[model samples]
Target chain A: MYQLLNHQRKEKLRSPFWTKNILMNILLGFLGLYLIVTALVVSFMAAGFIREEFEGRDVIEVFTAFLFYFFIFDLGFRFLLQQLPALSLQPYLTLPVRKSKLIHYPLLRSISSFFNILPVILVLPFFIMIVCANQTGLYSTIWIATVFSVIITNNFLNFILKKYFVKRPVLILAIFLVAGCLLYFDSIGNAPLSGYFAAAVNAIANLPFLFMIPLIIAALTYYFAYHLLRKNFYPEDSQTTRSRPESYSFLNKYGELGELIGIELKMILRNKRPMSVLIFSILFLAYGFILYDDPDNHFNLMLGGFIMTAAFAVNYGQFLFSWEGSYFDSFMVNRVSSFNYIKTKYILIAFSGFMTFVITLPYAFISYRIGFVNAAMLLFNIGISSVLLLLFSTRNSTSIVLEKSQFLNYQGTGAMQFLMIIPLLGIPLITYIVFLILGIQQYAVFALGAVGFVGIIFYRPLLQIVVNSFVKRKYVMSSNFRKK
Target chain B: MIELNNLKKVYGTKTALSVGQIIIPERDFTGLVGNNGAGKTTMLSLILDLIRPHSGAVTSKGKIVPETDEWKNYTGSYLNEGFLIPFLTPFEFLAFIGSLHGKNSSDVKDFLNKNRDFYTENIDSSKYIRELSAGNKNKIGILAAMLPEPEILILDEPFSNLDPRSQSWLKMKLKSLHLEGVTILISSHDLKHVTEICTRIILLEEGIIIKDTKTSPDTLVELESYFSVQV
Candidate 1:
């Protein structure tokens, strides 16, 4: 166990991504610090915010009523972001280590997940502010313990949920449906689930020994995960059922370019990580509802337009070449031209932007301003952002494992992805702000569209530039990819 | 033909591979045999331009492999599973490779039919390449390499995971390809298969070619004695 723990530390420290790139490490460290500080501030302010929103009500009771909502949201958050703790067990499978120890290593190591830490950061402060001040020491202590027990229970429950959900994706929709039904029922006053939930939690404080119920629940969840993991410890045993081969012969008309796009589409659809990224991007289309409802916030509207249109390009194109890192050698040795390879990526990202823009056209029914802004942003994204993203992608040498979950999997991210986002999103917003300052804000949208129009006209030459960069960096990227 | 001129690859202070002036002529069936760290794979990677050497160059058919991609048109090689796309099924992967070589689906079907002996039943299944067994994956890779019918063919450890029958079938298939005037370069730890199928054998030790000779009946015995003495 000690050796396993030590190996885990070395595994992280020796990750070529971190060890070779000190700048990336520092950037990631700062980003992590920023997130923790933000969460802490939010938690500190949460009690007062709740009190203000629900005036004339008992603050403790109100907060306690919402604890059930918080746990459900935490579960969903973890389901999306938390990675199954992996130790590359293939090598260890053949070693002399005990099977139980091997299984326990990852399970125990998962307790240290940022998902686990986040709840503590976002809940502990509120609990201290509200429960500690209003109740006796013993009561508050047991109350906090009950909440933490559920939190730890959530950590284990997520493992089982993710494992099963991967095998049966319908379970994901079912879970959402169940949660939605609960919310609906609670809102219509058909069932006072939140009130009962708060009473149960209050009971733990009133009778401190009842905290054992949550503790036992946490223990049971841990045992369930252990049992499931032990049963399918071998790699082969955990293999999902084979996917049927889907035909894309309709794409044959465009010849090589269409074939390439078909393969790329299949890659995104079939793989876990890329598919999740696509779904996440599609979800951003709803941003218009939030931003467009308020007419005065034109800047927010532009931001929303940019996000909705370029979400796929920014998210997926950030790791453009890295997507094929697994089969990079085949590409090098095969007869596929680097120019065409890059052009295919450009076409896909641009098409995604167009498709998103069309889907969001319905927003124009609400207001024509929403339509004009999204249209300009869409053109900018497909023209400028797409080309710029593909150009910057040539500098990305980190190889992403497409099979892994995307939530916190920072496998292929580098300084280039982060730096590129500044200009890709910033240029349009900066152009808008400049126009607003010049007192000609209405024409700013057209100016942005004109710039993108020029980019669209010269796309062939721009793509050539990206291809040149890719050809120059091919050897470096290939070598880095082979490291894994 | 492929030519290696003063090829040298260095990993830190150690010279992983260094070869000077070796020409692999057309239709020459060359086998590279060596110990674990003998730099066999490294040399192949350099020949394919998968890695850039510290000094010197590899030229295929008069064009430098790194400077021009013309060589990729007539060269087919599979160094490892990295050459196979995991999400693609066997048929899709073969078709993709064929398309790169300007072959349509009909052409791919023809190629599959021609190599029916080596094409296993698993290739017809709908499973992705990642789901297939190691031997089946190796077969798909080998078949894809040969699908384009290039002048040059290269494989690394092609016989490792294959069963005995499949191994012999591949040996026969490779021998037939050599007979059809395809230049072949393969590295294998199995001395018997290499000696039987390859017309020439090159023995590498510690980044240097210690022996280069035409393979005769006694070549396997010589290799066995050399390896046993080292052990």
Candidate 2:
């Protein structure tokens, strides 16, 4: 087993994927640290509430609510890993391993992996701070609850995600939505599902029932997932096709790269996995509108449009390298230039960004656009920013790790996003702010153009630098691409 | 004719190839036999100008340095993943390669028509290259190299993934091409196939040519002893 694992990597280590993996992991570790720090900062900012409300709030309530939120978010991530039905669980089904033991392995693996650890580190301390502030004898109860919550959430989420793949995603989403509503809606004020757990904690104020939910969810999800792991469970099985002799005429229209890129395009649309992230990004856009809830604020309106546009581009553009997974080596041998490859990706970004623009146009029109000047400015920003995002993403491609697994999983994003911190949110801010300061908000449109034009020219040099980096680091990128 | 003069290569500090001097006469089928990391690929890459040598250069035809246009126009080569476009259908991949060799996609298909079974497979060319099986992928790569009908052909581990039937079919094809005076260079570790088909053999050890022989291995025992191995 170990040899097979190492052997798969042997060929790849010589490929570019290996170096990319190392660089990405280092970047990922740092990014996790940054996120934890950021989360800590945010929680710290909210600490004033804990100090003020310490006496009325039973600190145990805070613990329960924390676990509840963890459960809610983690359930999504776990499912995406298909942890419930992943290759990681293959041995348990037949190796005389107990089903419970087999299922627990993933739970254990999850706990050991950094994603869970980072969150635990970020949130648990806050829970402890709340507990200490209360001086309530609730230490043991909270610790147990925390452990239970992590395990159960991880397990349950894995199982549901596997189940989601086993079923269709749309169906699974509908199920989760309905279940989430039914489970907690009727008992909102009383906090029905969580209320009982809250009550248990209140009774002992110091009792640790936090761990129970995760434990139950983990055990139950495992029981069903393992039971369902029948003879080489392929989450991708339903998508597989039996070999058949077929015509090549369908390739005609694509010209040269067309059939290839077209087939790849079809693969992406069919996967529907990334669509989940697309939905999430859209939700994030809606949240932006919420941040600028005041409709009368013109500056806020423009700010919202820029963000909506930027998110529309970057969110979709991030997965560019991954979409070419496994077949990327083929790209090197083919005659397609790196320019065309990157150009095609930019086209995809533009297409998707256009959709987002079209979808949100009424919103933009309602808020501010009354003339072609406004409309054209918005269009230019959308087109230009999307192109710039692809250029930056080309550099980041060396750092991104796209896992060829059941969709909706963590894509091994790195501190690569830090590069975006200044550009994505920054430039738009500076331009809009400067324009507002100058009392000429309209001129900001030209600034957007200038920034974009520089980006276009800069992409050429960036392309040279990055493509050369890619050639130098080709072996590393290819290897890591295959590993995950 | 293909010529190698004091060709050398190094991976970091490790020597990969160090052929002192050799000449591949026109119209000869040469089999390059070596183990994994035995520098077969390095030798082939140097000859193709895919990688430049540290000490010596390979000249194709009569040129000291191969002009990329003329050299590429008349040569068809495939090694590992260097022959495929993963996003393309096998048909698309073949067409793309065919185009590079100044042949249209339809011309490529027409060329393969005489070898229909060879070109035919239980894979949809409309499907992406990533979707094809290894054996079928080999079929596409082989076809891409062959469709151009180049004056020279270089293949690496060409039969590794092919089924026995496909292997036999390819062996016959190689024999036919050799008779047409097309020079062929094949790199592989399979001694039986190499000795059976090659007009001449070059055995490599530690990146240097250890043995070059013209003996016909008409019998199994003679073949084993030729490489100085006790079987």
Instruction: Calculate each model's fnat, 2 decimals.
Output: 0.86, 0.16
TM-score of each: 0.88, 0.70
Point to the candidate with the largest lDDT.
1
Per prediction, the TM-score for chain B is: 0.97, 0.92
Instruction: Write candidate 2's Cα lDDT for A38-123 as tens digits.
Output: 76774554456644766676545654655555556566555554343233443434675555544444444444554566566656
The DockQ values of the predictions, listed in order, are 0.70, 0.25
Model 1 regions more than 4 Å off = A1-55, A85-114, A121-133, A136-142, A167-196, A203-227, B11-13, B53-56, B113-116, B119-121, B217-231
**Cα lDDT tens digits for candidate 1, A1-484:** 8888988888878877676677767876897788789878977887788778988987777777787887888898888887777787888988899999998888999998787887788778887777888889998898888888988999999998988786555667577768868987986889989888888988888997788999999999999999889988899887766657788889988888888899999999889889888866876676677778785577777787787788888889999989988988888999888878888999999899888888888888887787888888888787788888988888887777988776656777767877988988788778888989998877776887888888899999999999888888999999988978
Which pairs of residues collide in candidate 1?
Answer: none
DockQ of 1: 0.70
